[model samples]
Target: MGLSDSEILMPASGADAVRAFGDGRDVTVFAGGTILMPMIAYRRYPQRARTLMLGRAGLNQISADGNVAVGAMTTLAAIAGSGVEPLAAAARDVADPEIRAQATLGGNLCAPPSRQGPRGDLQAALLAARAEVRCAVAGRERIEPIDEFLAGLDAEPRLVLGVELERPRRAAYSSQRRPHAHSYAVMAVACAELADGVRVAAAGVAKRAVRLRSVERALADGAAAEQASAGALDGLEPQDDALASSWYRREVLPVLVRRAITQLGGG
Candidate 1:
């Protein structure tokens, strides 16, 4: 079957913009155009983006101190070159350099789920930083926990502003890519001094990026790297792709987790 499409709505401010989300509305929100543009060209998207909201009513606004509140249309390049969390650096790890220049954090989160390594980077880093996602729907604006916010979301028609990753005591993210420049085969983020002893999240391993609770519990019991990782990811079956196998992810995940935890003074 083929597809048909209609109009584009341009929003000029944040308040009027975030309220545009609704159910049963076949609309595509445009940000850096990294994900949406290419998909449209290839005719892969099921819904037609009718309203091209062309304003930053809700996309642009960094807090006076350091908190960032970006409208759904913020771009990755903008974040990469800024003083935001090092996730931007992780995002820099994304392939298609041109795409990075046009990718937006809001787009990355709200867009369809991707298996690419960068998606993990954004989610994990944000989780580490205790990020918050602000969403507007049903004529009401509300903020949701970053981790909980993204959970169970299937990218329905909703207006998502850029994220806010609060400053952390220590946080780091690393990715292992196949050819070095291609998307990461496995990505890890370790956060310490966070409410939990250590929160480790990895992407590109399974259907959704996961936080290593076993590893966290081990560290809580004052375990060292060897014990922490050995128990944290002991028997999980990671998915295998062209770039890696479940065995490979299991092997490297612990090492990276150890390093991240160690750096945060967890070990």
Candidate 2:
């Protein structure tokens, strides 16, 4: 399948994008297009689908005060250079300079197929940082926690406007991948400070990137970092593929968790 007659609509503003999505027939929102281009070429997505592109949509801005706000079209490269700690660290590991320059946070969040496998790396890092997604559909705006938003990706009609997060006091992200910047990690862990205590999230170890609440509980109870990490993979079913076997992922998950926790000043 190829994009022979695929309709491409370039919206001039965010409001226009929302309007275009509302008329949806199999709409795929194109931001940076790094993720979508491959899906189109591989016939993973319908070849004749509608594509709502975020061009000149005023969604590429990044601003910060006490809280940080990143527009949906903001490039991964910009985020990597934004001095945002763990998020920046994770973005830096996404790919080489070129892909990063063309990848958007919104695309990454929504690109992953809604099934079992390694999803987006930023999802876990954002989860640990307690980020919120701001979105809209047909003039109706919605604001929700990042985790909840991710869980309902298929059902949500809202297009992501931006993400919001408070600046973290301490944060870190780690992943098991080849030294090559473009390689997909078998597992990734992120740790950060929260108002209540420390929070931890991991990617590539389950159907989707998720928080390790069991590990967070262990840390809150003052357990040793090694002990907390050792027990963290209790319920996760890490997948196996060409990059790594399932057992290898399970074995390395705890180590990544420990290192991330240590980096966050928790252990």
Candidate 3:
């Protein structure tokens, strides 16, 4: 079941891509290979029957006519320069320039947690932006809220096609990292003020980035930034990893949340 023995399927269009993905039984969808290649070299990657290379699937589009829509195949480098606020900043914070240019949005969304730490740096920002993920699952396409998509990620295998979201009136992002290209963030927070209300999310505190619903509710209840940030630990169960200890993540999450919220003028 090594890669050498696997069938490599490269689809030239989105339709054919999802059709190839079908039920995702023994398929590994390869995007930028930023996360996969390392595991591959270290011999830690799982063996699959097929590797679906999505390089030419015609999904690398970025649209901003009104509501923002970004194809899953779009590179982080493209997003960093797309003027998309917290997303742009989060994209810029990923790895070094070369990695950013090669790594992709879909790969980030679908990255499983590694032994070292959590992998999806863009999740918090996208969650706070109220992004919707458009993915092909079980032979059909569906769009769901970011949180819902993440909730079922471990239970299902889906092929991400793109993400769409309405721009927030104000947004901000904050993170603490070791100042290295390969270093994952110790903790990160993103906040946005949308037409409906405020949204907040955090990363590096769980298996995946999560929406800070308690914090958002507190904010809606007229709590100050500091008060709302106190709810950062509502449902999160932080775990110790190579980058930071559980206690450290618990202590600093509120600080990052407060900083991001305050930047959005939520104070």
Q: Summarize candidate 1's per-residue lDDT along 1-267 as a digit string, tens digits.
A: 243445656666665565554542666666666666667797765566565453455475555265555545556666666655546655666666677766667767765445432354466666666677877665567688876776746654456765665555566666666675555446565453554455666666656566777877887888987778676565467777655777887788777777777766667
Cα lDDT, all candidates: 0.62, 0.82, 0.91
Could you tally the backbone clashes for each prediction? 20, 0, 0
Ranked by TM-score from best down, the candidates are 3, 2, 1
Quote the positional error of residue 142 for candidate 1 in Å: 1.3
How far does residue 174 in candidate 3 sit from its true spot (Å)? 0.5
Q: Best by TM-score, which number? A: 3
lDDT of 2 by residue, 1-267 (tens): 357566888899988888878735467777887866777677776454777889678788888778999999999899999998778988988888999899998988876643335658688889999999998866677889998998887675568999999888889898888677667767889988867788899988776788999999999999888889987788888777666788998889999999988877777
Error of 3 at 229 (Å): 1.5
lDDT of 1: 0.62
Pairs of residues clashing in candidate 2: none
Q: How much does candidate 2 score in TM-score?
A: 0.93
Which segments of candidate 2 are over 4 A away from where they belong?
Answer: 23-25, 113-117
RMSD of each: 3.0, 2.0, 1.1
lDDT of 3 by residue, 203-251 (tens): 8998989889999999999999999999999988899998999999999
**CA lDDT of 63 in candidate 1?**
52
Model 2 / residue 220 / CA error / Å = 0.9
Tell how far residue 52 is off in model 2, in angstroms.
Answer: 0.4
